[model samples]
Target: MTSTHKNGLSPASVETIAGLSAGLISTIIVHPLDIIKTRLQVDTSSHPLLNSSRAVLRDILRNEGPTRFAALYRGLTPNLLGNSAGWALYFLWYREAQDVIRNLRGYNLGTQLTSVDYLAASSASGILSAVLTNPIWVVKTRMLSTSATQTGAYPGMIFGLRAIYKTEGIRGFFHGLTPTLFGVSHGALYFVAYERLKEWRKVSKKDQTLTNLDTIVASSLSKTFAGTLTYPHQLVRARLQTYDPGATKRVKGPGLVPLIQQIWRNEGVIGFYKGLFPNLLRVVPSTCVTFLVYENTRWALPRMFGNADDDPSNRTTVARKGERAL
Candidate 1:
């Protein structure tokens, strides 16, 4: 049976809450970078104007006029919703999967799960979360790609949702889903490496508790490693999401294979790594902050509003040490 905290939240619920908080905090901190990254990814043309980050920022400012700064946050609403819900669902599912695996293996709270176990759990949770939240990402992509000064631009997330549904049906919301599923390997790699790093630190330091600096290092290294390998998929997904075959005479096919072919034909291997610099810039700090918030929130939630003892995973190392000393 799942233990209930004093506040009537289960361990999984606490994880979800922690995840939501982390997502919101991180998104707010790095959303402008996200905008820059997305804009860079979706720019297929070789125009001199869109060549660099400075150029993109200048273009946005010039186009957006008085509210130029605010224009940087064009897709914030859907991004916030998608990221918050995705992280919440991911943590809830990941914790549940970990619990099930631990129980099946007859492992206690003190026992660490293997890297393979972390990979499996993280991949499953990440794919499910990615699929569930893809529609929100599609809307956000559309919002980001279109300028506020554009005549047919979506005024808000609701309008974007309505427009896509009314015009393109349900399939519209699922654009880039194939690449997203493939991108699940990013999360798998990140969590596996992160868990291994944390385990190594615990063993080296002889301490079960990780400091914030520890978390930041683990999260940043893992994110950079995973992100570099999987970044091409993100570029492909952004391209696919913003590509409107009906509106543009440039392409006849709307499928992933066709899109890949087009990008290959146009830009070769370098095309896949477009926006990679800004993406790394955006994701490193974003991952660090997210993990920091997530770890701290998870640590604090039960203590403040629930019974700390209710969470086996959150049991104090001091208590474990005391028990061992006895």
Candidate 2:
């Protein structure tokens, strides 16, 4: 059978690798911003006054200085690892499912997948990845959110994970699964919007010959647009994920109602979007780099490997194994 017609890749690999590469590159580039965003969201003390993003920024600078930049990457090791794995798994499953959906619906591959298709595939992938990688993310979030005192002198990701697992058990690792899923729906929305926007840009501009650059720019813009619109959900997700269940007065647990109520009671409705500015600042560039890396990597991979039809199964197998390891 031809490479395209064989079981190799099956379109899922394309999306998976692209997403994974993008996430890795983006994380590395914007990790510092992420640290700032996390600190702002998780700060519970009256000293910082959560209302002021500028005050939060000033505090980090005054107290931490350039050293604070290090805080930007507090959980870099696990976050990059987890993010890469998460996106890869998300894409693989998303693509595989999309393939099935396409087959059932009689959609032509050359015409591009639809938004609904992208949404369904990405949603399924997001949920699966959230469940599988919750532990890593939980550890990462804790490391990102807490101070040395709060963590009892634990300094790094390894110690952090050990402490949480030992103290809180497996359930602790899934602290914010619900909000995380809610937030990750943005990822689905992101890809779908990205794909559709790219297509529209290409068609409306009458540019049938699009390049990797075009794809990257289009994908970035779409993600930035969608990310900004849906950013409050992300703040809520982060807050929920990093909530300290063992604190003196704990916030609410999982589920939308309890989470909203707790945040409103403790920090007010505006609290739901506390770190939104910093988050937007971080997410836009992060997303831009992510799609750029993903699209460019995807473009380069096929050229490096030659035609898609040649040894498609081998390519798919290798890609799948690599994704699982991510």
Candidate 3:
């Protein structure tokens, strides 16, 4: 397809819809794994790292009985809310940044997008989204990581949201914002790497169709690499989010630095990566599915939603032969 007619969707809308769909679908698919990952990360015990996946399953079966799927999806509500909001914002910001960069660089619509441009767009979007949605994520993490005893209902997403608001007030929602922002750096890195890898794969194969498999591979590799590199921050974020403010006085909330020091003193460096293996496994597949779904949805939405030029939401004044703005 030529640049003007390519995909027939407005770039902006395509990105937004793709991100929303992908975030929602991927969250639902992988939420159980996510809950497990969170629990493993926040355990804070002196015991050596547990077999995260197995432990998660065991805990679910033991506590919730055989029908433990409900336990697995403990925080589905907060996850859906956080993920959908995060991805939608990320895509919108990323596309806007790309447009600004393209216009400033005087790049034509048909010109092949450079690796630098993609990285810049992805990083900007990821960081912005991370900052905006950190609070929601904090609440979600807290809800997911806590035991049923703490939550009183094995809490769905709504329960978590209500509990936070009722117990801790609105500020409680943002408990882990600092660590979450730090963790967002990982996301920025992941997106940049994913885009570059995808470009390399396409160039090597001389195929630019960006197939489903391609998206999956790119997303998995990118998330794995980035997730591993930045895992400590994520662990810290989860810990801080789930830390009980009302716990006994012996448990001091000394904030981020002290917590890090305490964890280091108590558990050592390996402690930071308590759930790394399961996280790697979960994140790779989850992210891969997410990006694959996102790209495909972007490709399909124009056909389903009508032409980009006619849609005011698209904001494209001129259409080239095979190019769509996104």
Computed on alpha carbons, the lDDT of every model, listed in order, comes to: 0.80, 0.65, 0.71
Candidate 2 TM-score to native: 0.79
Name the 10 consecutive residues with the lowest summed lDDT in model 3: 312-321
Superposed model 2: Cα runs more than 4 Å off: 1-17, 44-51, 62-69, 148-153, 243-256, 308-326
Cand. 1 TM to true fold: 0.90
**Candidate 2 lDDT, tens digit per residue, 109-203?**
45467678888887887789888988887777766665543425346778867777777677667777777777777878887877677667566
Model 3 C-alpha RMSD to native: 5.5
Worst 10 residues of 2 by lDDT: 312-321
Error of 3 at 83 (Å): 1.2
Q: List the residue pairs that clash in candidate 1.
A: none
**Residue 102 lDDT in model 1?**
88
lDDT of 1 by residue, 41-97 (tens): 888865332367777777887777359667888889999999899999998898888
